[model samples]
Target: MFGTKVIETFKEEHTGDVLDMMRDFEVKKRAISEEKEGNIVLRIPAAFAETYKSLNSNPISKHIFKGRFTETTKLKRDKLNINVGVSKQFIARSVSNNIEHAKRILAENECSNISTILLVGGFAESEIVQERIREAFPNKRVIIPSESGCPQRSSSSWS
Candidate 1:
């Protein structure tokens, strides 16, 4: 329960293996307003004994966390500590590499005379990407359409 809303609920029989269950859950799409760093607590039904047993039996689980797990019956939820530092670094690197590639493309194609750089698509919505592009090409005007995904109309809606 994340502040009173249930995100996911699964039957005990469905999640036979704990490791595979956790991996599958982690890969699923989740909505977050902003990026944050903290341990994500998952509240599973008490009947899910595989979660507890796997944590105890598997030494491979230690690869996820250096901290010790303290199981408490009084607690309603179980805590899963995962470090996304590597994943975050990978995304940052990919963004940087793409920006560098854009620069190379411009240079190789002799696009120096191009006055305006219009960024469209979903990736253009990223403030970091927009900021970096503006910084990279100080002289060129970086224009990001307000509703990038939507086509702009020249005439009034009534007409």
Candidate 2:
């Protein structure tokens, strides 16, 4: 009753796509790398099954906006993910901004001469971020552990 069409019609029209996209992101994100520029993605949230309009209303949880999503990842039993195609330049700029901010903080703390940078957040697991750090700080050593920062958290990725 809440949907514009009948329930069977909605499932017939949307479920295949909804599920396929979820499957794609779950498989693809693990293999993201510097050599391969993959689409950025967020999972199709669980609420998606409840209503198509739910994403438009939710901000913190919803990832899709303005026709930008490509795939989905429901790899976890209770999580949702969507594939995104973010611009490479955008990733570079974002990494640059974060680096600049960190440097500013270091300088303020009188550590301007620091030589090594360790990326430790969940974002640190990203190949794109790792690549950018290497490129941006060619003169400095960058250290990143192999494990994800918050392995148990559900949904979302930095795009």
> What digit string (tens of lDDT, one per residue) describes model 1 on residues 1-159?
121111222333445444454544443212111264443344444434344444445332232322223321123334343333333344467568988987888887588677898988655665556766788889889898886745677778659
- What is model 2's C-alpha RMSD? 11.3
TM-score of each: 0.43, 0.49
Clash numbers, per candidate: 0, 13
Worst ten-residue run, lDDT, model 2?
69-78
Q: Report RMSD (Å) for each prediction in the order shown.
A: 10.7, 11.3
lDDT of 1 at 94: 59
Which tens-of-lDDT digit does each residue in 1-159 have in candidate 2? 123443444456677756765465534543456566434544444444444444234332333333332333222333443233343445567778998987677677588688999888656776778887888778888998767554554455532
Clashing pairs in 1: none
